[model samples]
Target: MTEPLGAYGSVVEMLEAAATRAPDHPALVCEQVELTYARYRDCVAALAADLARDGIGAGDRVGLLMGNSAQIAVATFGVQAAGAQVVPLNPAYTESELGPVLKDADLALLIHDAGLEELAGAAAPKGTRCLIVGPGARDLTQPTGAPPAPLSLPDPQTLSTLQYTGGTTGAAKGVDLRHAAVAVNVAQREALLPTGPDERVLAITPLFHVYAVAMGLYLAANCGGTLHIVPKFTAAAVLRDIERHRITFLSASPTIFQALLRDPAFAETDLSSLRVCSSGSSALSAEVLHRWEEATGCAICEGYGQTEAGPVLTYNALHGPRRAGTVGVPVPATEIEIVDTDTGLVPLAPGAAGEIRARGPQLMAGYRNRPEETAATLRDGWLYTGDIGRMDDAGHLVICDRKKDMVVTAGYNVFPREIEEVLFAMPGVADAAVVGVADDYRGEMLCAFVVGAEGDLPEERIRAHLAERLAKYKWPRDIRCLAALPKTAVGKTDKKELRQVASVPPSEPA
Candidate 1:
């Protein structure tokens, strides 16, 4: 709730203060176990001392591979307090998916949940030491007699987290972010969606994601609120926890929200304690939004950000207008502009679609070890987000599409989001994803992959819906019906996979 700390402040400092100020307050909850701020701080201090003893020091990159739980929080704070940069790995990642990142980062150490020890071990480089936590895991020990070692606090410019970009478009790259930037980003989120000290935040999304970390765990700690961590998302368990804990705030993806809406007990569950719900990672369909609001009496505020900007740029207004199709005005201390993609200099007029350029304290330093990519993305002090969007007169920003996601067919530029939105508005559609497919004559064609509410949706019905709402050129040339659309680790549509599927022959299933 406090103003973002100045350059002198670091996340470690802020967390330490939170513990000191409210030692007796419940800081973290996971299932039946709850830890007070005092206990949390002591655990972190003990772990920090152990990590330091093991030679994990400033500038070292420590990879964390754990599901969402109280231990994840402890490891995050402990590793940072020991002055090491944390690289969060997806707990669900296959060895193939996680191997490249481990090798690319050249991690100094790997900390993983007991359940994932084998996966983490296989991914870790030969020399990187491993620390496992959870029941039956290797114990992290600190000497009993001596006082806990003092933390080596990082400076404002110190790299805090090496957040990997979601590879929906291409290969994921490591984004180098500073401690000050991460702290400011957390503060900006807090400012927009203020949670009371007594509030209970339900964090069902993976904690490794920037959105979940900022909106749920960090915000709760920063505001002296309690964070109830769900190791993995299950709609029934989530609903049970909401009623049991009287959770007031929730942050999840559109897919998760939709799943919750479809759960059998959704109508009967007591959601009266809920004050707000945040949707991100993908577009929330109008059907899902209206149904959820009508059922729960809570608004689903959509926000926007990417890996390079400490992961949060804007959010729908909590106290003012909450638009359905737009990611609202820029957060405090941030600047946004739509500019010509080619020149990156000419600022487009209002309501004109262009690539989004942003600059703020939360922007990352650059992409780690990729100087050319870094130079191309970070121009001057502004971060050129590859996302294409337009700003309305009211200052709300509507994303048109990703620059790479645009399909140029027969001299017409078509954004997939435009078609996908119309598909989502249809009655039988449960989920939809649009991707560009290479065509022999037109250069590129549209392909729509849709999941219906029940049974396969007829292709003609989808075509009819599109014909009425979109131009002929924008209509999908091919439609693929599936049980569910592919998703990335962060819960966004896996367009890269869809593009691959689109390249195959029509006889092949996606």
Candidate 2:
């Protein structure tokens, strides 16, 4: 029987326990390099010593700015081992893009990749020190000092990570996650997607994001499983590695799954070893879902959650009936209720559309330094997820759209997701985003930007398709074909940018 992990005060303690139990097991694998549990633990210890020497202690924020790699896993464990809260920064951020996060975090030291030193230097606030990790000028990944003496375990409520919510709506706010909360989140994920000690998991999702950390890093570490880490995502490379590694488990976004399906090699690849594939971050379209399952003969379980809800609220079952569009049932030890959007107090009947509210041990403590926002979001132990969705008759959760993403046109509320889903089902349309643009006739007009897999789709064919299914008000007024949709740092389609593009008037045909 698996022992209860709640007794462990911190994530570091949990990791230490895993390392002690399976010192010979391979904990992390990046390309040709495999770091065994014992070696990984020592690296974490040495890095922790280096961090302690730099004066980062409990409650101090240590920024991690890098793409996904073995170094990220090592640095994350090392930072927590030193009792410091981690602030993960997107390495793709330019100086201007990253400066606000650095200043807002008020970080003691920013640990960044060796390749991003110049960007880090430009973005870092005055007096903020930088520690380079990865292949070169070093700190945590390569330690010169003796291994630090083990530190005392932290309190259960001690803050572990200040993960920023994806800024699709507005500026990203830091969500505070305690050690206990993170542990619970990882356990919740494992409950739904059970794995054994010998499971080989492949992770292509960015670790800086909360979803990847909870599902990929922590999940693999907790079970003492081998994790094959990909630093960047490319469909061909990901497919090649999956076949090469004979990976048993995979956690990725729908965008990646779609790309894999598009790649010619995916059809020929031997995926007999695959046990389960989990998709999140964005809604998985039915077309993509059907294709993947048909090709791989494995279910792609789609789950739903945000950064604040320990990053997982619901998942399709591993053994039971797996639904394609629905996110399936809530994970064990979690409760989800569809409440009326206006009052947020009354639980709606089944099949009713409402705001999704969740309560579980894994929920974040609150938003960091933003009491008003925190109070608004986390109320009376229930975290009010701003996403709008409905529960089906079978108790499965179907995410309709984000509350802010709902476009109010004329007198009707048109959800962009509804239109986007239709576009996804249409042949030749690879990606789609719908947003409201200013208009005098209908108060706001629905505009769509799409990327075509082959070439530009005929405008009339798209209009005719939506016209047959949707009401006139729900129909998009303008459709612009592009090479690809703009993506947020976490890889969700950037509707916020699409709205900006929609506002511009198109020039007359040349």
TM per model?
Answer: 0.79, 0.80
Candidates' C-alpha lDDT: 0.81, 0.81
Model 1, range 1-510, lDDT digits (tens) per residue? 465444225677767777778889998899766788777777778878778888887879998898888888888888888888999887766565577788888888899988886777776778778888888874332224455644557777889999876333335578898988988888887677776778899998888877788788777877778999998778899999899999999888776787788899898899999999988765566677888999999988888988799888999978889888898889889999999988989999999999999999999999888898889899999999888999999999998877756665543446787678788999999999999976644556889999999978999999998886664767889999989988999999999999998888779764
Give candidate 2 misplaced runs (Cα > 4 Å): 1-8, 139-143, 147-152, 167-169, 406-510
RMSD of each: 10.7, 10.5
TM-score of 2: 0.80
* Local distance difference test, candidate 1: 0.81
For residues 151-269, write the lDDT of model 2, one tens digit per residue.
44666789999887533343557888998888877777777778878888998888997778877888787888898999888989999888998899988876678778888888788
Q: Candidate 1 at residue 348, lDDT? A: 97
Question: In candidate 1, what residue range of length 10 has the lowest lDDT sum?
Answer: 138-147
